[model samples]
Structure formats: C-alpha cells, structure tokens
Target: MSSSDIEFSSSDYAVQLDLIGRVNGLTAAKNFFSSLRDQDKTVKTYGALLNCYVRVGLIDESLSLMKKMKEMGFLSSPLNYNNLMCLYTHRGQFEKVPDVLLEMKTNGVSPDKFSYKICINSYGARADYDIMEKVLQEMDSQRDIQMDWCTYSLAANYYIKAGLKEKALHYLKECEKKVGNDAEGYDHLISFYARLGNKDDLKRLWDLQKSKCRKQTNKNYIVMLGSLVKLGELEETEKLIDEWELSCKTYDFRVPNVLLIGYCQKDLVEKAEAKLQDIIKRRKIAIPNSWSIVATGYMNKNKMEKAFECFKEALAIQTQNRGWKPKAGLISSILSWLGENGEVEDAEAFVKLLRTKVPVNREMYHALLKAYIRNGKEVEGLLVSMKDDKIDENRDTMKILSLQDQNSEVTG
Candidate 1:
C-alpha cells in the first residue's frame, strides 16, 4: 500500500503471500508462504517468503531466510535490501539495521532515500542526533536521485520523534515544496501542525486538503472528527462536530458519550447523568469498551446508581451482539459498589437477575452470597458449602440454593 499498486504476477506469489500475511497476520502468512514454496522449489522462490515473513512480523525467520537466499544464490537486489531495511526500521531494531546497511555498502549496492530514512529512524530512536545529522549530510549529496514525498516525510517524522520540532517543521516544508501542492503533503502538514499545537495552521491545512478532495461529506467528516477528538483538542473537536451537523448528514452517527459531554472518566455517576439523554438517544454501541467508559466515568463522579445501570445496559448489549462474557466480570465490582452504597435491595435484585442469566458464573455466585450476607440470613449454610471445598457442587447446587434464597427474600 505504501508503494504504488504492484502488477500481479505468478513470480510474485511470494509477494502476494507476504501481502496476505501483513493483512491477515503472521501465522496466516507463514502458512501461505510455505504453501507457495511447496508449489515450486527449483525456481527463485523465498525472496518473497523472506519479505512476507518480515512484513508479517517473522523478523527472525526473515533474517534466517536472507541467509538461506544467499545459500540458494538468490542475489540480493534493491528490493531485497529495501525489504530488509523496512523490517528493521519498522520494528525499531537499530543494531540490526546498521548490519544490513554495512552489507549493502560492502556489496557496492548504493542506498537510496528510503534506505537512509531507516537509518535516520534508527538514530532518532536512540536520540543520537549527531549520527542522525551525519546521515542527513550524507543524504544531502544523494538529492540527484529525485527524492519523493516518502523521503522527506520520513525526515520530518524522524526529527519530530527526536524532539527537534523546528527541524521537523523545516523538513516538512521542504517535503511540500518538493511535491509542489500535493494532496498528501497537505495531509502531512495538517498532522504536523496539529502535533505542534498550531491550531490555526492545522485548521488551515485541513481546509485546503478537504477542498481538494470530495466536498467534505458525512463519511469524510466522521473520519476527520474522530482524528481531532483523538488528538484531545476538545474545542476543535466540538467545532468539527458542530460543523458536521451544519453541513453533513447526521445519519445514525454519534460521538462517544464521554467525548461529547466532557465527562470526567473517573466520575462515572456524573458522566452517566450528564450524558443520560445521549445514552438513551444514541443507539447503544456494541463495543463493551464504550459501556465501560461511561460506567467508569459515572463511578468516578460517585454516581453509583447511574453507573450500575450503565454497566447492566452494557452487559445486555454486549451479550446480544458478541456472545462475549468479558464484561460480565464488571458485575463483581458493581455488586461491591452497590453493597458499599447501602443499595442492598438493588444487589438482591441483580442476584435474582444473574441466576436467570448465567447460573454458573463465579461473579454471580459471589453476588448471591453477598446478597444473603446483606440480609443477615443463611450465611452459615453457604459458609459450610465453602468449607467443604465442593467446587463443582458450588458451581451447581449451591449457586441454585443461593439464587432461590435471594428470590424468596426479594419476593417476600
């Protein structure tokens, strides 16, 4: 995706395997590349296999395959060097990177801008500005190769990571000048200006990019709005959200409740109360994480009652969509909060509900015991069950007994 779309070829079965692995995952890629090797062993094969393994995060395998490539007389080409540098650079493995560069230079393979980008990144990672500057000087002499956007964009990024904001800004402008009004350059400028906290420049760059592209429609606005919100620029985020409502289709989209309402994450009670209308009006998010965010926000605000309700709502939504029980664990903390807040009756109700939902979950079992303890009745019998260490019986008969007792207490 970084480079231009490669034309599909039979010789590139390994490259295809690598791409598939990157998209799917390392394990999937390994399985795929191995299958390609099995397809034909006599030909020039594993160069792509090595590249794929590198891409899919099989760094050791990629390296081992590099040695194997030499053994099999697959002479190291520019693509081979490029892929190797990419592997080390992407992984931030600096010591390994120089060894590859040394190999390239020894073999009289002239390194290019992208190759130096890896070296700059390696030095940037260690904050070694001296060597980084040396690499930049060396790069200055290689400008006749016609450095592309990727070249200086990487330089800008490297400087930014090195905490040299001025240098980053300079290189970024140089990148723009090289491209002469490219759309992606504008996008990079927007990101860099945002990073620098130059809100005016950021907005200006965004506007320019937006104008060049399609007419700032709903989907595009959503993407931009998310990027702004994630940057923690609350005022800018609000401005974009309001702008979207004015110009674009609202559709069924809604921002995260906490982001929309400025809800304090640790104050779940107040967060839920503040966004209560949004919570109801915005169709529920199937992500358990969103529910947890609201729930935590309410709890931090000591809004225990609202927090409990939010978690329960999230549990139901999560169960329906994903059949995932990950969030059921939150009930333990919620039940604890309920008991602490003297909401004994609510805790008992939840225990009754849990029995009807997941009968054998440990959290439900604990809630049932806690509810009985709250009422000051039949704690002795449950303690006896605990003492017997009848773990499986606890999973079944004892849980049922506690549920029935809680139900009787609640109903009566």
Candidate 2:
C-alpha cells in the first residue's frame, strides 16, 4: 500500500507512528495532533503523537500525551502502555512510570512483557534488589507475564551492584537450571565469584580450564582477578595468581588495576608507573582510574613523589575533558602529601580551588600538630583550635590518619 493509500484511524495509529518513526516525523506528528484533534480523531492523533515522541526519545512528551489521551477517554491498551513505559525506562525514569501503570489499570489495561522489563531495569538501576526480586515474584505470580534471559540478566545486575555476589550467583544458577547452561551467564557468574575471592568457585573455574576443557585468556582472567583486587581480597588474590598461568599486563585499564597493584606488591616501581601511559595509548578509553591504581602502587613502593604527580595529572586530565572532578583519593592524596612536605599553606590554597567538592581542612589541623611537634610552636592554643575545628572523619580523612608520616613515603 502507498503512504497516502493508508487509512489513519485509532486502530492503525500505532502502525503510522512506526512509519513516521522511521522517517523522523516527530514535529509533524506533534503538530498534527495539535491541529486535528476532534473527539473522534483526538484519541488516535494523541496516541500517534505519543509514539512519535517516544520513537525520537522525547519520553517526557510521550508520557504527557499518555495522560492527555487518557483524559480524552482513550481506552488502555497493552501496546500503548508497553511502548510508553519503555520510553520512560530508556530515560531511567521510574517514578513517572508507575503512575502511567496506575492509569493503565484504571483504563483496564494489563501489564505485559514490556512493562515487566521496564520495572526490572528501573529497579536494577537503583540497585534495589529487594524490590527488583519483588518484581520478579510479581511477574511469576501472574501467569500472563513471562521472564526472558534479558529479564533475568537485569535481575542479576541488581544483585551484582548491591554487592550481593552470592545472591547474584544463586539467581544466575537458577537461570542456568531454567535455561540449560547459558555460557554468558556462567562467564558473568565466574567473574562475580572471582570478585568475591571465593576460593571454591575460582578453583572450579580454574579446574575446568586445567581439565583441557575450558579456554581462558588474559582478557577474561584479568577481568575477574582485577575485580577481586578492588574488593581487597589481597591474600587469596596472590595465591590465585601464583596458581594460574595468567598474564594481566595486556588487559585494558578497566581491569589492569591488578597489573598496577601487582607491580606495587613486587616493588616494580617503573612498571607500575608505566601502566597508565600504556592505557592512554589505546584509542577512545577514559582510564582516569588507572592513575589511582598507579598512585597506590607507587606509594606502596615508597614512590610518593611520583604518585603525587600521577594523581595530579590524572585529576587534571579527567576534570578538563569530562567535566568530572576526581574523588575518593585525588584530593586526599594532595592534602596528605602537602602535610608531609610541611607545605600546609600551599595545601590550604589548593583546597579552595576545588571546583565542585568541599575538602576537609584537616591538613591545617594536622599541619599545626606536626608544626607544634617538630617546631614546638605552642601546642596549648593549637590543640584547642584543632579540637574545635576538627575534620569530620570521612574515608579520605581516615586514609590520611592511617598513612600520615608513613615511613615508606618516597619516589623512585
């Protein structure tokens, strides 16, 4: 059928929306809705407008139109609500979605695969596995709804993000039982187990390799190993690396923190320092985190000066291009080093220049502490001042305390 040969009616509105979606007629669709909305034509026109906006990722408009269509007495439908919910979901907009769902129930519409998936993904984004599992339970309760691999994959993501590795493994294992041994889920499960430093699971995965049945690569090995390192399962991690004939140097920055940390552990200062530069040579990868790992390694090997330099470079590079300020250690390292170097005045100035984050002025308190101890500059007044204006103990503050005046502070 020709384009004009098509009849534009309520039943056919969705189909027309698909055609216009392909042609990118979003504005035309919206203008058409505004211009030609009589009671008879309004429902279809508004629905078409909603579909067009959703197609173009104008989800707010699609949601707004859903409300207008409902107010105009358009009947609830699986296709309509499903599509609208999907649009809301792609934007990660969950709060608005349940209201549309309520409207669906009010209009006698039933939830289907699309609505179910949206809820799964939204809850996963929030890492609210309790509610995410509830969604799965609710879906299971209704015979009309069904779960697919993507559905279960999303649920598994909820567990992973929430640090419920055991729960993730259980859900993925259930997925395997239900779906006859899925390889992707198994790979992911192994990765999670490796992250948790679960010896039994890691051994099994390794034994599978040793039996001449499973093929492993640096990519996959480091992917798992690096995750374990970040979780700080250091002793188990060392043994695993010694057990496996694995190499991590070739992995991307996403998983190469292991290489950095391993170099630090072995006191391979230059190798640790070069990992960041190696990652930078790759195309189109934002490895701001490589510096953090490198800095730690350098610091461990008594290379604090170079570590400080690397941190500054990383923070400056990250902040300049991406508009994201570094945190968790970037500022802390600077303040800590400035205190150690007895450059408290310079550190105080640097703290003020932080564009987005507020720094605890601990360097001043502790700086004076060191000053009083080293230079004997009157502790009576300084002690009272520090007590009154103490730094609130955050993670960075705690790190400063643990590492202050560390004997291993140096650079190669």
Candidate 3:
C-alpha cells in the first residue's frame, strides 16, 4: 500500500506496525516506527508500538516509550495506562499494577471496566483481600461503570482461593445473574461450582447453559467433563463425553483426553488404556500424550512391562505429534526398566528412538551399558560410542563397568 496510490491513514499505519511487530520481531517494528513521518506518529501508531514492546517483554523499552507518549500528551485515554498495567501483570509485578490504576485516576482519566478488573485481579493475586474488596466496592459505586459477569466471576475465583465460601457464592450468584446467554460465562460458573464441590449447582447451570447458549463448543464440553471428573463422577463424565460426541462436528482428542486423565488420576489405568484402545479401534486420532498418560499410570503401579508397552506405542507414532515429548521422570524410569529387564536389542532400539527427542544423556548411556552387561554382550564398542558422545564415565558408569568385568570373568 505504501507503493500504491492508496492513501494510508494513521489507523492503517498503526495496524501495519502491529503486524510487523508480531511477525518480524521488535527491532523491525522499531525501524518501521522510526520511518514514520512526524504527522504519521499519531497516538494509534505510538500505542501500537508500545503494545509491541510490552508483548515482547522489553520492560525498559516499554517504560521509555510510555514516558515519551506521556510527554507528547498522548496519555489522554485509558488504553495507554491499561497497556502498562497489563505489562506489569504479565511480568508478575502485580503490586505495581494498582499503582498504574492510581496514576490513571490522578491524571483525570476515569478507569474503564477492564482497568478496574486488572486492579482487582492484582490485589487478589497479592492476597490483599481488604484492598481488593475496597476496589470492587469503589468500582460498583461508580455511576458510569456497569459491572459484568466476568468481574464478578473473577472476584469469586479469588474468594474461592481465599477459602471464603460465602463471599465466593455471593459473587458467583451475581455472576450468574449477568451471565445471560454467554457460554464462557457458564463455563466459569461451572468450573467454580466444581471447585466448591457443588454438584447440584454444576448440573443446574450446565442445563441452563445448554438451554440458553445457542451452541456448546468443544471448550464447553472439556470444561464440563473436567468439572465432573474433578467431582469424581466418572459415570457423569462418560455420559457427557457421549453427549459431546453425538453433536460435535469435529472430533477433538482433548475432549476424551480429559476423561483419560481422570481415569489415571483415580488409579484406573486399565480403564484408561481400554478407553484409549477403544478410540484407536474407531480410527480416531489420539495424540502421543494419551498413551503417555496410560504409561505413567502403569509406572505408578510398578507395572513396568505394561508401562513399556504403552510408552512404546507413544514413541511409534511420535512423529504424528511433533510437539509431544515424554516426561523426563517417566522416560528415566522406562530407560531404567529396559536396562534391568528388557532385551539388549529392545534397549538399544528404544534408546535410538529416545535420542531423537532428548539429548543423548548419561541415563541413556547407562541404560545401554546395563543391558549390554546383562546380556553378556561386548562393551568395548559401547564404551567407544559413549566417548564419541562426550559422556564421561561417572560413579554409576564405573559400577556398571565393574559388573561388566565380573560378568566377563564368569563367562570366560
């Protein structure tokens, strides 16, 4: 558009700068902002650049730009201050967030709904319930402010965390009154009810959500399913999953993974694996973590053989889920099991596949050495490989080497 005959407005330049920051990194965004003519450096463009700096977590740069924006009288709106509050919140500087709100008020800029919400959240996060309640009261008293379900829900969440059940229920009731037909609002209410272990309220709100909300999304199902699971109602969870499957347009594995996790948490590994296998039988796509979940369940039960089988399944189709990696503790346990009880060839093959995901570590080498020694196989080549990999022999390595020597003496 810059090269075209189209006239670019300040808003267009701001959007372009935002896009550049997101796609090309902060340096490119800074360069683009610098290239802008003085007239083009409007509040919109400056705010966009400031947003970029906040997004990339450049604290010094964000503050410097905010100072510049303030000096130029561009801090007339609540947006600039809100961005700073968000930055502080994101960086875990929750205590500083309220100070930004105070600054906004001091500058004669009235705090918007989001501005008040952020301040409330910051106080809640700090466990400063006195100040949080005071802020909420002030926000409620503001004539221009119309409190939404989200604010009430957020306050209720913090109340729940503080173990103030009555206060939490009050806010939750207010939240429900404002929910109207919003599915996300119902989701929060459902989750909070579950946290409170109020199964009846959970069911009531769920029914209400289904009746009022036009559609129940996958996220909705996940939340409901997870809530039921949290209440230890696997039967209800199963029924909900069936309901979701009947109407869902697209199959999302995360929906079932919720129950899979629930089953494992309840020490029902066989049930979880059986459910996973049932999904696989239907040719439904299950991610690697699904198998890993079952594997972890078996590991906890000390069923190493079963764990090995399930984890092997996870590794076989790992390429299908590139982002999935087995947990380090689980991997270590499996490697140790393979070294002690697995076939020498099996250990080598598993390690070969494992190396692709994690760095070749001392645990991998030790597992291989144990397997080779147990099988009465040659260790010279294996030691050479370890040396090539720059894995220095430690105490465990020396102990395994001593075992290998003892085995050689017996075999000789």
Candidate 4:
C-alpha cells in the first residue's frame, strides 16, 4: 500500500501494531509505534500500543502509556480502562480494580457489562461478599445495563467458593433463566452443580444441553466428564464416555482421561489400566500422560513392577507426545526399585532412556551403581562415567561404593 501511494488508515496502523505485538513481540511493536508519523498516532493506534503493553504484562509501561493517553484526550472509550482493570485482575491486584471502575464512572464514561463484571469479580476474589453484593446491585440498577448469564454465573461461582449454597443456587437459577439455549452457560452451570455435588442437577442440565444445543462439542464432553469424575460417579462417567465415543467424529483421549484420572483418584488403578489396554487393543491413540497416570496409581499402591511396566509403556511412545516428561519423583522411585530388585540390563536401559528427558544427576548414578553391585558386575566403568559426569561423591554415593567393596570382598 505504501508503494502504491495509498495512505495508511488509523485502523490499519492499529491492526498492524497488534499484529506486530503478537508476531514480533513488544520491542518490534514499540519500534513500529515510534516510527509512525505524529498524525498517524490517533487514539486507535495509541490504544493498540497500550494493549500491547498490557498483554505483555509490562505494568509500569502500561500505566505510563495510559497516563499519556489520558493527557492527550484519548481516554474517551471504556476499552483502555477495561484493559487496565483486566491487567490488574490478572496481576491479583484485586483491590485496585474497583478504583479503576470508579475512575471510569467519574470520567463520565459509561461502564459496559464487562466493566461491571470485572469490578464484581475483584470484590468476589477478595471475598468481600457485602461489597460484591453492593456492586451487583449497583450494576443491576443501571437503566442501560442488561444483566447476562455470565455475571450471574460468575457470582454463583464465588458464592459456591464461599460455601453459600442457598445464594449459589439462587444465582445459578438466575443464570439458567438467562442461559436460553447457550451451550457455554449450561457448561458453567453444570460445573458449578458438580462442585456442589448436585448430581441430579448435573444430569438435568446435561440432558437439557444435549437437547437444546444442535451439536455437542468436545469441550462440552470434557466438562461433563470432568464433572462426573469430580462427583465420583465412575459408572455414569463410563456410560457418558461410551455415548461420546459413538458420536464423536474425532477421537480425543482427554474424554477418557477424565475417567482414567477418576479411577486413579478412587484407587481403582487396575480399572484405569484395563481401560487403557482396551483402547490400545483397538489401535487408538493414547498419550504418555495417560499411561503415567496409571503408573502413578500403581506406585501409590506399592506395585513397583506394575508401575515400571506402565512407565516403560509411557516412555516407548513419548516421542509421539512432545513436551511430556515423567515426574522426577516418580522416576526416582522407579530407579530405586530397579536398583534393589531389577535386572542390571533393565536398570541400564531405563537410565539410558531417562538421559534423553532429564540431565545427569546423583540419583541416576546411584541407581546404576546399586544395580551393578547387586548383579555382581564390575563397577570400574560405572565409576568412570560418574566421574566424567562431574557428579561428586556424596554420602549416599559412598554408601553404595562401600556396598560394592563388600560384595567384592565376598567374591574374592
């Protein structure tokens, strides 16, 4: 457009600034804003830059830019103020959020639904129910403001957190009235009812959602499955999984993972493993975390051999699921078990696989030494590797070495 002599509109510049921030980061955004002509620095462009600052969490820069925007009469809309309030909320400066709302009102800017919601949330977060109620009342009394399900649902959530069951139910009823065939609203209400352990309501809303909404999304299934798991309704969870599997066009392991996790939490790890095995037998895709979940459950039950088997299953297909690493404590426990009772070859293979995931550490060396000593294998090569890894001998290392020496004496 510049080459064609087309002038850059203010909206264009604003959009370009946002894109720069997202694609090239804050420094590039700043450079672009700085390079803009003075006339091009309209309210939209300036607000865009402010959004960039807030998005990146540059608190001081956001405030300074906000001040500059106000000085230049660019603070007419409530958007910039809302951005600041959101920033403060994300930063956990809940106390400062209401003040921003007050400032917006005092500046003669009409607060939007979002502005009121943010303030209500701030008060709720601080657990100031009285003030939260007052803010809700104030928002309700606004002649221009039309209350929505989100505000009511948000209030219900905080009420649930506060253990005000009656109030929570009341607000949830209000939220349901406003839901009016919206899937997301139903999802929130379902989750809240689950939190309250109201299974009847959970089933009711889910049924209603399935009938009213034309298509159930994966997210909806995930939420419902998670809710059932939370309520310990494993039987119902299984039925729902079957329902989802039949209808779902694409398979998502997360749907069953909810049940897998539920099984583990309830100490029914064998059931979880069975379910995973069934999925595997059907040639379905399962992530490492799925196996790891079962492994963790077995570990809790002191079934180290079963845990080791599950852990190996997870490690075998780990490359298929990037960014997944076994928990360090889990690995340590497995290593200790292998050193005491596992084959030397098995320990060596496990440690070799472990090196790709985590750095060389004292725990790895110790596990290998113990396995070698127990198998009556030579320790010279292992000691050289440990020294080359620069892991200095500690008390535990010395103890393991002492054991190796005693084993040698016995052999000699």
Candidate 5:
C-alpha cells in the first residue's frame, strides 16, 4: 500500500519499527520511534523500540533502553527480561543469562518456557550439564509450566555435542513423542539421527513422519535424502527419489541435488555426471551447483579436461547476471591447464569469459602469457595486454618471456 493510504496506529508503528531495525534500518526506525514518543505511546511501543536496538546489535543503546524501561515500570513484562537475556546470549555472555533469569524471578515475573530454555542453553553451552539439568528439573517442577518438545530437543542437541549418547538418545525419544506433525521438528530429529549414526531410528522416524504428514513437502524429501546420503546410503536415496517423483506436485531441482552432492562426495563423479545428463535428457532443469560439485570431484582426481567442461557447463547454465563465481582455486586450476594444453584461440576465449567473473590476477595473466608463448604467438603482445590490465610482470612471467625470446633467436 502507498504511504498515504496507510496510517499506522502506535502499536502498528512499533511493530514496524522492530521489523525495520531487524533489516539494518536502525536510523529510520529510530526516527519513527522518536516521532511516536512525542505522541501517545504504550509500554508495548517502548518494548518494540528496545527490541529494535537489540535486533540491530546496538548493545549500548539496548542497555540504556533496558534501564529506561525499568525506571518506567515497563520491566514487569517477561518479554523485556527475555530480550535482555537474548542480548546477553548474543553477546556471548552466557554467565549473564542466568543473572537475568534470577532478576526476573525476584521481580515477580515468572519464567516462561522460552526463559527457562535460554537459561538451559546458557548452561549447556558452558558444558555445565549439572546446572542445565537442575534448570530443566526446576522448569518441570513448576505447576504452571509444561515442558515442551523444543527444550528436550535442545537438550538432546547439547548432549550429542558433549558425547553423552545415552542421555541424548533418551531426550531424542522424548522429543520424538512430542513431534505432533511438525515438519521442522521431524527434520531436526532426522538430522540428529544422522549425526548419531542411528540408521534404524532414522528410518523409523522417516516413516512415522510420512504417515503423520498429510502430504510430504519438498523440504521433507530433501532432509531425508540428505540424511541418507550422509549415512552413505546412496542406494536408498535413489529409491526415495523414485517415490518422491510419483508424489511431488511440482519440480524443484534441489530435491535431486542432494543425491548429486552425495555421489560427488564419494568420488563417484561418473555417477553424478550420469545423473546430471539423465536430468537434461529428461528435459528437467538442474542447478549450476550440481555441475560444480562434479567438477570439483574431477579436479580432485586430476582430470582437468572433464573438470573444465563441467565448469563451463556450470557457467553456461546460470541466468544472466546471476553473480555466480566459481571457487578461486577451481578457476586457477582450469586456466593453468588450458594454457598448457588448449588451443591458443580457445584459451583466449575462455580467459575472456573468466575475466567477467574474476579480477585479472597475476596467475591468470601468467596462464594467458604461457598459452601465447607455447603456440608461437606474439609473447610481447600478451605482455602489453598484461600491462593494460595493471598486472605487473612477476618472476615467472619474466622467465616465460625470456625463454621464448631465446628460442626465437636460436631459430633465426
């Protein structure tokens, strides 16, 4: 809607202020909040403005706002306390999180699930498992509070990180029981199972999620496929692809990209290339990243010709002006090989394309120079070209030019 058509109330403006600040529009949000301050504003407006400061990572401003909020009796809300706790957590001051929780309690503000979870995370991050458990136990003991699946899943995550597999498994089971058709929850559990190498558990949960969800989404397929791939079960992932093709309503290249990545990861570049060709033959679109992965695999195998072709395919598939640049090392490898072996005209054409994506580095110029020297073309002309590109002649460039001149004198 046009600005003139939209007249936001104080609360609407407050939410907008918070949103703007989140996107790094702090100056604009601050000005708008200041304008609202002179008019009628509620505690919610103050809270939103404080949230803006926090979202923009203005720590000093956030702390000042917190003090102002307390003096104005706006600290009675759990949201204000939680925001401070979040700020401390974001700043890596884990020790400060518990203090905020304690202050909240002393102020007669009951800790919500989020408050307790944040405190638990703080302790878990410090590997203070004893205190983390105590906080969780305390949360469970509260008559007004009911434990959530998120807390259990979070506990499981930390336990997994800490190498407490038994406790992690227990909490994971608890979390699974509370999944309740939440797709993200299922994805989290699947990823955790992949980390734990619990293949049986992963399969069971995948089936359970499929039965619970009304219609499996592309993301669900991708997550499961990725987990299977991580477990080195490429055969199973391919079978699932068949199932997904039958059920999916729309085509998203990312669904099969997981398999392409997996095959390349295993050094099976041929299989990955075969899959890519199959997709093309079937008239389905594949993403450039898939081709790049296979290219990387070929590079690792020292198959520069195949790698260069795959890399070229990746560049050709990109939409106009997509800002895609291949990794630097990959570009260097292909250019160096092309200079040594490719036709001089082909090397020049490819280097021309490469310049569009990367700056003219000394190494790339060296390649073009070597290409010209090897093909008995004008090495001096390439030197002039390098000068125009502002690339100074290095020792290697001098060596190449000197050797070419010596060969020319001997032939004359």
Candidate 6:
C-alpha cells in the first residue's frame, strides 16, 4: 500500500489535523497540513496548523504562520490574536501580551472579555497594578462584556500575588457575588480564602456551597477539608471528616490523608500514626504517600528509628512503573543518615528499593559509598557502577575514599 491509498476530504483532513495537534503530535499534524494545496485549505485548517505550532512551542513558526494567515485574510477574529497573546505569555514575553491586544482592537476585531483578561494578567504579572486596574475598569465599563466570576477571580488572584490584600479581598467578594451556585467558582473562592487565611469567610462560603448544591461530592468535601487543614483547624477538620464519612457515597483516602499530613506537620506524629492504623484496621490499603507523611513526621521529631521503619513501609507499598517520585531531599537525608549509622546491607537494600521509584542519582551513590567505607567493605565495584551510570564522583566521594584509606592503614 502507498500513501495515496488513503482518501480524505478537506474537512475530514483538517479535523484530523486539529485532533493530532490536540494530542501534541505536532510533526505529523504539520506534515499532513502542508500536503494540502492552497485550494483545499480553509481558515480552520490554517488555524489548526497554527495551533499545532503553538502547542509544540514552535514560537518562530507560529509567528510566521500568523503573518501568512493575515496575508490570507483569515486573521480577523479575536481568537487568532488571543492565541498570540497566550503564546507570548507562555514564553515569558508578558510585555508583548498587551501589544497583541492593542493590535486586535486596531484591526477592528472587537476585544472580548478574555482578551481584556489576558491583558490584565499580563500587566499583573509585571506588577503594574495601576495598568491592571485600568484594564479592569475598562472591561467593566464595556456594555457588551459581562464580567464573569472567572475573570474576577483571576484578578483577585493577581491582587493577592501583588500583596494588595485589601484590593484582593474586594475582588474576592465581587467574585463571590458572581459565583451563583457554580461549584468550580465556589472551589476557587475556597482556595483563595485559604491562602488569605480568612477562616471565618472560608467557613461562611463552605456553608453557602453546601446550602446551594444538592449534595457535596468528594471534590467539594476535599476542598473544604483542605481549607480547614491549611487554617490549622484540625478540630473542625475532624468533625467534617466524621460528617463526610456518614454522608459520602464513596471512600477516598485523599480526604483523610489531608488531615493526617496536617497532624504530622504540627508535630502530632502519634495522632497521624493512629489515623493510619485506623485506616488499615478498616481494611483500607494506605497509599505510599500516607506512610511517607508519617515518615516525614518522625524525621521532624528526630526519631530516626521510627522514621526508617515508616520509610520502609512507604517503599513496600510503592507502585512500580507509575510516575511517582519521592521528595529528593527526604531521600538524600534518609540515605545519608543510614549510611552514617546503619549496616551496609540495609543501605544497599534501601537504595535498591529507591531505584524502583527514581533513577539512580549521585546522592544515592554517595550514600551507598559512605556505607561501604564506614563498614570496611570493598568499593571498587561500586566505583565502576557509578561510572557506568554516568554519575561523576565529586569531593564527597573523594572524602569517603580517604576515610577508607585511613581505616585500612589503621587495620594494617
């Protein structure tokens, strides 16, 4: 069979090109699009190719494509200009965002609320509060544009980022008024309120959400619990957990994990352990994250034995071939501590376990070397393994080797 064996209409071909772009198959999408002659190309086809370039981070290609699009008289809509603004933002060229917005208006493509919102974000990102406010005011004054909760919430987020707490709170209140029983909108407010540390407002909004929605889903409960935990209101979180257990339709460990981690963060390791034990007693399988949190808690309190036990439990339950990586700092600390004070066999076993989660890095090799030298074990094979892994030995490795030399001399 040849490439000509396949038959596709222009619309079908264009649609497939767009689908390919959506899946990030940029090369295939561009090649397929380029094969079509000028007569077969539509504005949508051009837009799809442009989107493909954008999705693949081909900024220069996208810019050239935009020029071609304008020459073909298809760049008349705000959507095309919005794409440029988005590309600029993604590339950290924030200052160029408002320029694209201005060009859109100059070309007689009436700016939509999203266009204005992007400009607002651009200004806010640069910390130009005055221009951001001006853009917001102009957006509000536009008769055709009805400001939505998302836009207001976006503006509130920028205000918070700028440390303009008063202005941020004002916009948050406005965002709340525009919410109107939108679950996602309520969730956004809950998150922002958590950041602002306004427990009272968070509680009030939580109540409002419950009353407006027919019943809370796991998402709703999780968001609310997360807020309470951030506020360090563990008592309230516990009560809410009990309530959720009674009312929830499904059992999700995520909700309880939030509080358990919170307890550990506050140095209440015993409480975290009890919660973990309770979950296991109920025949629920705890995730590696749950055990990792307890391990972190023990480490915080300087209980190395308990911490190692918890870390072992975490590794035992770790899912293989999943895109999960433990905290590199925790891994380094535990391995270093163990190498300094643990048996060589134990260090080797833990490193083997860690390779199942993350790639073998210099830190792991360093820890293993320290263990081997401290226990008077041969390290020639370990040095060869490090070279094979392409991890260069640094000063720390030299120090470990020197320690081995001293130990051998003393024994001799």
Top model number, lDDT: 3
> Whole-model lDDT, candidate 2?
0.60
Q: Once all C-alphas are superposed, what RMSD does model 2 give against the true structure? A: 11.4
Tens digits of per-residue lDDT for model 6 on 122-225?
99899998898899899999999998999889889998887889999999999998999898889999989999999999999999998887778888888999
lDDT for each residue of candidate 2 in 33-104, tens digit (9 for 90 to 100):
455436436555556666677777886676677676778667566667877777877777776666666677
Please report how far candidate 3 places residue 401 from its true position, in Å: 3.0
Model 1 ranges off by over 4 Å = 1-39, 42-44, 51-64, 86-92, 110-114, 133-153, 175-188, 217-236, 250-258, 261-291, 319-335, 342-368, 377-412
User: What TM-score does model 1 achieve against the real structure?
Assistant: 0.67
Candidate 4 vs 5: which has more lDDT: 4
Per-residue lDDT of model 4, residues 1-412, tens digit only: 5578878899999999999999999999999999999999999999999999889877899999988998999999889999999999989899999999999989889998899999999999999998998988999999999999999998999999999999999999999999988999999999999999999999999999999999999899999999999999999999999999889998877778889999999999999999999987875768888999999999999999999999988887788688897898799899999989999999999889878777989898898899999998988898899999998888988999899778889989
RMSD of each: 7.5, 11.4, 2.4, 2.6, 3.1, 2.8
Residues 268-320 of candidate 3 have per-residue lDDT tens digits of: 99999999999889866678888999999999999999999899888887887
By lDDT, the better pick of 2 and 4 is 4
Q: Given candidate 1, what's the lDDT at residue 77?
A: 58
Query: On lDDT, who's better, 1 or 3?
Result: 3
Candidate 6 off by > 4 Å: 1-11, 19-28, 380-395
Q: For model 5, what is the C-alpha lDDT against the true structure?
A: 0.85
> TM-score per candidate, in order?
0.67, 0.48, 0.91, 0.90, 0.87, 0.90
Model 5, range 1-412, lDDT digits (tens) per residue? Answer: 3268886676777777777777767787777677774554668788888887777567788889888878878788689888888888898989989998999999898998889999999999999998998998999999988877788999999999999999999999999888899878899999999999989989998998988888789999999999999999999999999899888788777788899889988989899899889977875656677677888889988999999889887777766326566788888899889878887887887777766666778887778777887778887777788889888987887887886887688888
CA lDDT for candidate 1: 0.62
Residue pairs with backbone atoms closer than 3 Å in model 5 (clashes): none
Instruction: Using TM-score, rank the candidates from best to worst.
Output: 3, 4, 6, 5, 1, 2
Model 4: pairs clashing at backbone N, Cα or C within 3 Å: none
RMSD in Å for candidate 5, one decimal? Answer: 3.1
TM-score of 2: 0.48
Please report how far candidate 1 places residue 201 from its true position, in Å.
1.4
What is the full ranking by lDDT, best candidate first?
Answer: 3, 4, 6, 5, 1, 2
lDDT values, one for every candidate: 0.62, 0.60, 0.93, 0.92, 0.85, 0.86
- 2 or 6, which is superior by lDDT? 6
